[model samples]
Target: MSATALPAGHALRRPVLDDLPEVYRLLVAHDVSVLGFPDLTEDDLRDEFTEPGFDPVTDGWLALDADGVAVGYAWACRKGTSADVDIDFYVHPDADPGLGGCLLTVVERRAGEIGRELGHGRIRAMVGCYRVALGEAALLAERGYTVVTTFHRMRVTLDGDLADLADLADLAGPPVPSGVTVRVCGTDEDLLRAAHGVKEVAFRGHFGTVPQSFDEWYGHFAKRSSTDWSQVWYAEFDDEPAAMLLATNAFVETDNAGYVQALGVHPRARGKGLAKLLLRISFAEMSRRGRTSAMLGVDTNNASGALSLYESVGMRPVLEIDVWRKAITLG
Candidate 1:
């Protein structure tokens, strides 16, 4: 029945640039979401606070213990074309409650600043990939932030109906449909560059319209992934690049769970079953490797009927979850 002291268990407060390393370490330590995004390097931590258009001095804060060790951090910025949270942040393990509370205060403070600057009434705090992490998600949910939408961490089995994907095994694309050529891709530098190019084109207008820089794209996804270039494929019509399906396996410590990471096909080359074709390859290949199932995430509202396609392939939704969010108010 005793009152707890401030800055005791997990408190929040403004953070200096020096705390970047601790934040990065915290992210690496407890993230358990479906594998996405690159792990930030130690050197990258230094510029995290002020990277390009993001400056932590005014937009960031950290949660620290009485000993001044960082447990959690949060930062916010103005919303733009991407419809981002502007408020992005996280906390480390065994974070102090007092310190965590202070960090949330900073999140609110920055949210207000963004609202004022943008002349808007509401602000959003975007958390990247809400996995099993509690300190941040629980904190936000407690402060009236509910999950807004959800991106599925879905999976499907490879044993049943290999026909949908098997047909493409011998797919002999038309002889150079003018200037395009389709072939299984290699993990070489050139293919990586091509993969980057196609991704830029395909995702440019997709959901979360945030355009990623080449470095961000490479480091966060392509380069950072344990991508199996042998399994990657590219479609070229008339010998000109058009689409790709990038697949990789992240052998988690569990029994027999494999992941079908990315199943992207460029916009210009839609309607051709290229995705189904590539998925078949990945499925058959995964089955060959002693793995029983493959998993991939798809936007439920995707215009591409991605959910349907996945279901058609024996990949059903085992669970449904939402990304709830409550707008931050400056008034």
Candidate 2:
């Protein structure tokens, strides 16, 4: 890939694996400036660079100052089972305003190329950022993007006292309803298929739903070097799996926290309290592993009453992430 000319004092070039430290530094600095703490971890950066369907050499770009320090970074990856692409970029607080729009323009064009390569007739460019990221929100709006949805980054402390520990231990017996049982996924092929099937059923009709084969879904997870399949659990009611909770250490690795990558309850099992059961079980397991907190992101308008459920379980909103989308038109 050839370098792209940027502002007079900066140059844009393809990002390589070795650029992760500098890229992550820029991302965290931007994140902390907006959210009061770092949101992107080194592992997150690494995964983005190596995820399937994306070639860093062509899809990633970094804006560097004359001194060679990265001041901005952008990349796009195809969303599973769709012609849409998700683009994420971060600019240092000190970077030129023009750099933000420049990076976005490049990624948007790449998204269109990705769409055509995937044999899609139309494509969408989607992005997300903390609500506090006013500069990005304004830039997106100026560039014709619209706010499509909002998500809450919910969190809860797992460090419980003696009484709490006793309560959790009491729940260890059987957290689910009378006929339901919960267990971690097995490594066997059949068990993996069963777990993925439960996930597919549970997430149907959810916002931004994109159906993916088990291989694709698991492949994405496998890219995250820290993924622990043992933390992924499924709930079976009367010998039939009905719910799934996929957990990971992706975001909170340095914070000693656990993250719920996905939590879903089948429509048929909605009123059986399986969702809450899975959450409590996850919290207990995280605590057992010495994690001090648990975190997850959820759409504020989820049809499953997940917002209220999380609030009831002591999870509170720690950050607001807004999603913006616009159609892509290739030249």
Q: Estimated TM-score per prediction?
A: 0.62, 0.92
Model 1 C-alpha RMSD to native: 6.5
Error of 1 at 323 (Å): 2.8
- lDDT per residue, candidate 2, 1-331, as tens digits? 1223377778889999998898889988898888788876788878878999888898998899889899999999887758778998789988877788888889988898889888887888999877999999998998899988899988887765435334344434334568887778856566667778888988887877788899988888877876888888888888887888988987556678899989987778788888888888888888878888888999998888999988877788988999899987655
Residue by residue across 1-331, what tens digits does model 1's lDDT show?
A: 1122345354555667666667777766544332233344444455455455456777776666667666666777643533245556554545544445555566666667666776766666555445444555676677777775667767765455545654423323212344545566674667767766777777666555566665665555443334456767677654556677776655432326566656667776777666776666666666777676777767677777788788766677644444545566567
- Choose the strongest candidate by lDDT: 2
- Residue 178's lDDT in candidate 1: 41
Q: Which stretches of candidate 1 lie over 4 Å from their true place?
A: 1-101, 107-123, 128-146, 159-181, 213-215, 222-228, 238-240, 251-256, 318-321, 325-331
Candidate 2 residue-wise lDDT at 229: 87
Query: How many collisions per candidate?
Result: 44, 0
Residue 295 of model 2, lDDT score: 89
